[model samples]
Structures are given as structure tokens and as C-alpha cells.
Target: MAGGGGALEIPERQKRGKIVRRKKKKRIGFRIDLTPLVDITFLLLTFFMFTTTMLKPQIMEMRIPPEMYAKVEVRASELLTLMLTPENKLYWYKGIADQNNPPQEISISKLRALAIEKNLEPTVKNRLITVLKISPEANYARVVEILDELNQAEIPITEAITKEVDEKGEPVKRQRKFTIAPLTEEDLKLLQGEGK
Candidate 1:
């Protein structure tokens, strides 16, 4: 009773003996019930999982060309064109347009792999010219994903559309033009598997 619980001793007179006393030992060892603690921990975990907000994805920054005055010529062998359609399908071409070589339809995730497969080194010494033709009807999220993939692959981007005030003081859209040829109907057929 002194410190929670303790031994008790009793003194009494017996019939045959003069006096008799008994000592009772205290129960020292005790067990702690951790069931409530475990339950509380799980409840807190569930609450935080349901209430807390997930972190936003980090955005990648790309360098844009200032002016289109200076023209740069990229070789046909060093070109890789990635075209995004309105249906979210991706089509890629290794080099310049030709009857023999046609654009192939590829998946979004395989872009990086295809770049590596075609040996499109994004270094300054052997720069691979990559042109991304994103259709106006394409989703902005798909374009962002493609840009992210390009950045993740450490490829240098060379194109940007900018609005500028012309010498006549009128705002006009300006874009740097590469020497790459435009996509033809044959290219579309190739992408659609008709040219296969």
C-alpha cells in the first residue's frame, strides 16, 4: 500500500500455539498493455494520410532562342522529329523525309529509349537536332510530359514561338525556322500504318 501495493502480515492466536503470523509477498512484476498504443498509432497514420496534401511536381526550365535572324543548318542525318497528334499518339522520324524511310508510331514512354537507340547524342560535339511538332489540338499536359521527357534526357531544345512588336509597331508571332522539311501526306499515312 505504500508504493501502490505491498506485502501484508497478520498476527493471531491459535488453539494449539501461542501466536501465529503469515507474510504475503508482493506481486512485483507487471505487464504493460500496448494494444491501445498500437491502435492510436494506426489511427493517427490513417488521419494524416487522408488529410495531408501531396507535394507538387517540380517544373523544368528550358532555354529559348532570342531572335530568328541567324539561320542554323542541321544535317538530315542528325535530325529526329517527334510529332504529337490530336489523338495523343506520338510519331517519330530518324532523318529527313524519303520514300524508303518513313515515320514510325511510337509510345510516349519509348521516346527516350528510341533516342538512345538511334544514337541521338545531345552533346555539343555531336548535337542531334530534335524537332517537336505538337499539334494545336494536342493536350497541354501531353506537351508538358514530352518536354519533361526531353529535359530528363538532357536534350537541348532550339525552338520557341514568341510574340514581338514588328518595326511597324504591330505585335506579330515570331518563330525560329529550322531547315527541316515539312511533313507530307505520306508521313501521315506512315504514322497511320497505311504505308507499312
Candidate 2:
């Protein structure tokens, strides 16, 4: 607000026996409205809240083997089975499990090196079928790690139920194409060990 003069009056001065009107002084005051400021602040906050990106869970990419591809037979001699436990223990075996070639216990840290070695092996270079027999209680990260290693080695991923042999003492059914099989108690004892 502005004013022409203050409420208090000044004393008159005698000048040449004639009364003269004095010029009024300018006065100033200020008032601020905070409602608009508060409204704008809230609008900015709401805009950021709606426009900002929130964190999302990450999912691992997987390559699922085709159904027709699954129909192709895989030989036991060309198969490599890896058993993963919840304790991070890895048991791997090449070919059919027998007294001559038994499952060897290893650590997860050795998988990358093993993949590199297998990639160079003639038996596993191209005809190899790796079956991941993961336990139900195993951590999901363990499976992802194995899959990543396989990817690094340029190995194909698969999932299928396999058969060992027939009544004729011959491998009538095999790990049909390239696939990952769940580790059942029977499969664990057969592929890993009885103590597993």
C-alpha cells in the first residue's frame, strides 16, 4: 500500500506572513500471497512423481528349445549332465553314469573354465547335449549362472524328460534332443551319487 502522507501532522512554519501548503510525502508497505507459491510447488512435486521412473525387477533371458527339435534323439555318449544343489555344489558327469565314469563334485566357480574346456573338446564341440539337473531347493541365480556359461560357450539350451534304456539292454530312449531335466531323487542317485 502507498499513501500520500503519514497520520501524524507536521507543525506549520511562518513564512512572510503567508500560509503555504507543504508537499505530501510518499509512504509504502508490502504484503505477500503464499498460496500461489505453495500451489506451484505442489504441482511440480506431483509432476515429478508421475513422470519419474520407478525401479523394476530384472528377468533373465532364456532360449527355449523347439518342439520339433525335441523330437530328435540325443545319444548318451554325447550328453553332459550337471547337477546343482542348494548348497552351491555342482556335480557333473559325462556320458552315461557308470563305475568307469562317475560324477565329480565341483564348485560353481569352475563352471566357466569347464565350459571353455568343453568347448574345445571334440566330443563336446558340436554333438554335445548338456542337461542341467537343478534341485528344487537350488537358488534361481545358480541356474542363471549356468545358463550364462552355456551361452558364453555357445551351447544350446533345452528341457525334456529322458529315458535311460529299454528291456533289450540298449539305449532305446535318450535325453531327446538338447534339454534340461529336473533332478529327481532317482535321477540324483543315478547321475550324481547315492549319498547325494
Candidate 3:
């Protein structure tokens, strides 16, 4: 006979008719601690949350007139037209674009200086209107670049346009005189040297 705590016994019969007792073994159970693993997981999550950079959407602001059909006549002498072609070529001309006198090709790098010079001209100071005509096939990035240059040119030009104050004694806000228009077929023909 086998006795006691946590032990199992089996009875066996011997060849001489005597009974024998055998003991059974106990099995151990295993357990794992998940606290450290959970802590590391949370730590990595927090690290990424604190270190990751979030991208913000870039935007350009434009103001449009209330009346779409209203025609405001602009003098040809005060007009500065910039035409962008699909080939990434830039052409600029003062006054109206005429086939007899084609637009002069200009590089993007020199555009800023030209804008400043034209805007500061004695005859057209504070009155020059810049018209940007973009071809549908032109790169959007190039248009952005041109707008950026025009914006950069605004600061100095605004400063030069009299330091007069408004009714509130704040410096008068002179909006840049620029507009965007779609390139016409005639303009494309002019750029392709067909008009010449």
C-alpha cells in the first residue's frame, strides 16, 4: 500500500502471490510573465508617436472678384504678359501680344528682376498689371514657381509704392495686380514660331 500527499499508487501481484505498491510521478506546470513584454510594446509605441513627423498640406491663397462678367479695361502699355508653354519655355512681353512683335523668351531665373523693374517703371509704377497665361500641358510645378517669384517680387514693390497709411494709421495694403488665364490657341501658335 502507498500512502499520502500528491502521490498515486498502483497495486501489483507478485509471482509468489504477494502484492506490491508502485508510486506515480508528479508533473510540473509552466507559467510565463507578460508584464515586461507588454511594457516594451507600449514603450515602442510611445517612442514612435513622439518621434514621427506629420506632414501638413501646402496651400496657395487667391482672391477673386465678385462679378465674373464685369469687364475692367486695362491699358495695353500697362500690361505685362507672361506665357508658359508645354515645353517649359517662358515668354514675356509688355503690352498686348502681337504677331508683328512677338514675345521675348526669358529664363525663369531672371523673371524676378524683370518683374521688379517693370513694376518700378516711372510710367507704369503701381499701375502695371501682370497677366499669367498657362498652357494646359504645362507643368504645375513651373506655375507654382512663377507664382512664388511674383510673390517674392511683391514685398519690395509694395515698399516702393509710397509709405502712405490707411484710415487706421496702418500701412495701406496694396494687392499685387496679377491674374491667371488659360493660354489660347493663338498664343500657342505665337510660341511655336508660327506667328513669326
Candidate 1 lDDT, tens digit per residue, 49-72?
A: 999989877756656677645767
Best by TM-score: 3
TM-score per candidate, chains pooled: 0.50, 0.53, 0.66
Most accurate candidate by lDDT = 3
1-196: candidate 2 lDDT, tens digit per residue:
1342553332222332234455545667788999999999999999999998898877766667656335666677777788887566788888887777778887767776775565446454445677888888888887888877766555321211113345787643322234676778876666545354
Per-candidate clashes, comma-separated: 0, 3, 0
Clashing pairs in 2: 158-179, 158-180, 159-179
Model 2 score (lDDT): 0.65
User: In candidate 1, where is summed lDDT lowest over 10 consecutive residues?
Assistant: 155-164
lDDT of 1 at 128: 58
lDDT of 3 at 64: 75
Candidate 3 lDDT tens digits, 66-178: 77667889899999999998887899989976766679888989999999999989798888999999999999999999998998888888997758676888876666688
Candidate 1 deviates by what RMSD? 14.8
Q: 144, model 3: CA deviation in Å?
A: 0.8
Ranking by TM-score: 3, 2, 1
